[model samples]
Target: MAYKAHKLLEGYEKANSDNLPEVNIIALAHFIAKDSNFISPEISNIKAMRNGRESYGESAIGYVQLKREGHITTVISCVAPEHKVTSNGYKVEIVVDSSKGEITSCKCYSCIAALGGCKHQLALLGWMHRRFEDKTPTEKACYWKKSKLSNVGKTIKFILVKDLGSKSKEKRKNMCKKKNKLSSEIIQKRKPKRKIYKVKSKINVRKDPDGVSFLQEVIAHMDCKLKKGNVKVIPELAKIFLPVDKFDSIDIHSLMKDELCDEVAKSTSNQTDNPLWRRLRYLRITASNLYAVAHCNTVNGSLVDILHGAKLRETSAMARGTRLESQVLQIVSKKQKMIFERCGLLTCPEHPIFGASPDGINENFTVEIKCPTNYKSYFNFIDSSGKIKPQCKAQVQLQMHLSGRKKSLFCVASPEFENNRKVKILPVDYDENYIRAVMVKAEQFWKNTIGKFVLE
Candidate 1:
């Protein structure tokens, strides 16, 4: 039974390209693997080709083999020079269909970016192209020899340019070192010369005045300006420069509250296009990101950078949610028979740096709406069994806390469902423990990571 199965598998295996004529193999390799920027002029592709050419010229390619099945051919090779200690380098494979006149796939087993095509595969391809370019139609040069790298620490102490191979005896003869009198003269002339200069050190004899003297001078100047009725000198400027008896005596909480209120008033519209809204949200750790901030494990990861005003490009799902939010809210309001009033950002009084901008708020509860882009997400929301996603739960809890409400309605909407089943409303009660834990993490993150960017 094992022999029969082996025979069947052998019948299905692709034929080795070694059986094909040398001319045909060379033609196929050249057609698929020739280096040119005409097909793809991207910088990344050009860079890969440049590195691959260097690898090919360095004789890094080893143990190349080809397999053919109908019109498709696959070239496989080992690239051995990339690693200093390991003899078995990355396995690179390139698949090409001559009938299509294009490479179907290229992969490097040891490369992280193998899915996107890597340099090792390109090195094998360039090696094939060099073989085709170097050999004539009538000459059948064998490509089965081991790579130069395979002889490292054995048979050869080191590899040199002269050892790679010489096409002509004259070229080999001219490879010997020759003396250049002109180069030696140029090097001698370019040598650096030492120079010495006299230096003297000086010290100031005068003593600097203290802070009180500078403050008295500033106060006297300001008083003189005020007495002259100089309208250019504003009273607010005097207040800023004036020295106070104690810094702790200032009402920082009231000042922060007033500043936050002013910002909220400026960004009351809360629309995405509003510049003030974007700017205000850009500075604060908004409720939507609370879950990520709470759960992040690294101090300087991408999440911290994002919170520090790094702009994230909008995805299709975000665009869809933004476009369908108003319609979903209308549907929920109509179905629930309650008016949901749209409100601007609500900042926490105690933690002024944290804020939440809920979808809508009423006398009893705040509302947060979600529009899932697909049926799977829609169904997941509908069949959640009184459990909410951690991120969504965190957002709603923060919204409820900021709005001073005890309950929030988590609504999910999808237009693809039937009209009767288009919206799913789940009532989420405010959880004090969860919100407290989240706030602790958020505070630590803000102090350790985001405070420098925001406060400075």
Candidate 2:
């Protein structure tokens, strides 16, 4: 159990991300009313950002251009409601913008922030799209894209994190009932038998099958139901079957920023040809910059001010009451074990990992007794704002990628140092480019700078 916390972090990440509903604001607003003019062009952009249109950069504001019609849904529930779904509903407000008089940008704060898609959004959509009746596919959608909800409609908020149907309820009840079946909370060992039966086999097929042989058989037995040819695989794999991304590869000139090359240009003070420190610094800086751009808000042609009330000082308060900021985080994390669903609903996917399990897992997504110092340091570096101190998602991404999971939940121990911690379900999209970049920087530091003398 010494390493129990590690598994807990993984579990926390997995459990938080599980089956929460995602409803598009544009679609939801339209469904509410069309004549309502709250849906903004920026909100529409967010809906189209994830499509096939490739835009590459540290942030979405500069590089991405969304052309297709943006679709946003008010809110949808994974859990099927009994007579009525009470929790899954919201009033999605939108602001439409036209620069040079073209429809663009949509800001959907209420729709995404509060998981709601009740009749409010639908009615709003209806009002916007008055061309049709209060109900219809096209009318509902158009209304959402152009409408604004009434002041009364803006007050609803709901929580629909999972698909809890009648069947699920019964299953949950059965699980609860099974908990009582344990007569005693004790580990019981089986009594030893006097002598084990020994049978001598004449056949010599007992050669121990090593991993390679087992793996060969595993590969041979696997099949894809949809494959018309033996070589066919999922369509997604086929698209990116090309070589690794050139942006972070041997073609360093194309992928890396000029700042990295500038490091190599520096005069070497170390006698050894390799230095790890400089390389690590470069890796950290590049990754952190990208992460910062991703997390900083950009809803209304404005980036959110992260340091609004943050106080910066080298001084550490020695008073017991003030010295307990970190302690509160630990306590809050411990108390939040019961109501993880609430955390999942509030958590943002853009956030970084928290309370990590050190060197536990490799790239495949795992954990162990201990990990390399670099990995542990990465987790410890998180700041009080519930943001990772390194300001990068690389390490967490590596953890999730290694675990073979596409998403995980990250909880920030409350900044207010409260007893209850807030959790966010972060979606980790593994980028081999990032992993390779970090390694390359590590290697360069060891080979060409003062870092060669230090472990770094």
Candidate 3:
């Protein structure tokens, strides 16, 4: 039999009357809690319930319909808040045996977990339960109206004071023009006018009166006397001043120092084998994991554990890459005729929590070497045609950014190829927009996940 998509049932009367079918609210709660259809982690279940309640409150559930055939009652509704602008929503259908006080069948349409159950299904169940709990005899309000979530995408150009029932523009202008006499008097007294005066000199002096002699006297006063010797000199002055000719002859290169030389001096030395390298990258989101952090949907338990001091065991593939990294770098350097210097943990100055450690870096570009463990993986890298995998691309971009280089070399190596074709080097230019997006995700993860866990 061909599988057909489920559609909503028609001809059922809308559930708007005060008198509605009796539903076991407690049973519904028990189903959500223990039923295999809705089984999930406790935290996920809690989040689902919260989300369902929010959906119900936001009026995401449309007009519910109730139909009866013998002792079985069928309830149908649509959950519409999933999309911001679309009128279409997940259709939820529940079949209950009213005589047995149990839900025999429940399913939701357009949901991946429809056969079992999903948050949307649970939301409809919750909405029905809440409706049943209301003991008032008043007529139930119609829920056929559009959900509030649909309005989320709406744009408001501007808001006026009249829209908020505030004073009008004319009233405001009139109020600004009206001045109290007492207030005006107080303002005048608070600000006093500046007074102008004319003066005449009583004594006459020469235009130039021994200026050089006065300067000499000032300099002489600044001079200090030695305790035991008859020598006068300025305090804290250099003991010996070299002549210009002698200074010129001295080595200026020896005196000039590079400030960053000290900071990155040990950078190339901290590799995976070093304990300091792991410690430095322990709580930081490095370039390699930026893609995962950005595209993560739920609490990434593995990543979270790793962030919380859990050691990541190197896989066979990773070990292979590590072993071949140096060989790949050598091949690349030999072919490209460029000195590729190894780099260690390089952190962003503006965002300290984010870091990167490129395989190699030089004056022109940073390098990232990948040695695939299998031929299939190697071919996949090759098939990319210079536009590498998104994760690898993000890693290269971040490495370039962290190393302060405008370009990067993505090198791929495989043993099966000939020596001349052993390694492939692709040039990748720095992408500011992509880097900014990655930084935003990194910051969110650092603050929300890592920061929260540390606080706990």
Pick the lDDT winner.
3
In model 3, where do residues sit more than 4 Å from their true spots?
A: 1-268, 379-386, 415-421
lDDT: which is higher, 2 or 3? 3
Question: Please, what is the whole-model Cα lDDT of each candidate in the order they appear?
Answer: 0.59, 0.27, 0.60
| Per-model TM values vs. the true structure | 0.46, 0.20, 0.42
lDDT leaderboard ranking: 3, 1, 2
Candidate 2 Cα RMSD after full superposition onto the native fold (Å): 27.1
What is the per-residue lDDT of model 2 for residues 407-442, given as tens digits with 9 covering 90 to 100?
A: 433333222333333323232456667654554443
- lDDT (Cα, tens digit) per residue for candidate 1, span 1-456: 221211223223322222321223444345434544322446455656565564443477755566778777776666765446235566677676654445666667866756555666667666655553443335444444556766766776776655553235665455432235446646755877335221111101111122122112222222344335543332332222223243433332332344545357335645566544554554367888898888887887888756645666554457778877777888889988989887676764466557787888888888888877555456444565657788888899998887779999999876453354487788999898989899888867766664433221
How large is the C-alpha RMSD of every model relative to the true structure?
Answer: 19.5, 27.1, 24.7
lDDT of 2 at 72: 21
Clashing pairs in 3: none
Task: Indicate which candidate wins on TM-score.
Answer: 1
Clashes of each: 0, 81, 0
Error of 2 at 122 (Å): 60
lDDT of 3 by residue, 80-138 (tens): 64544354577678887654555677788767767666777777777666665555445
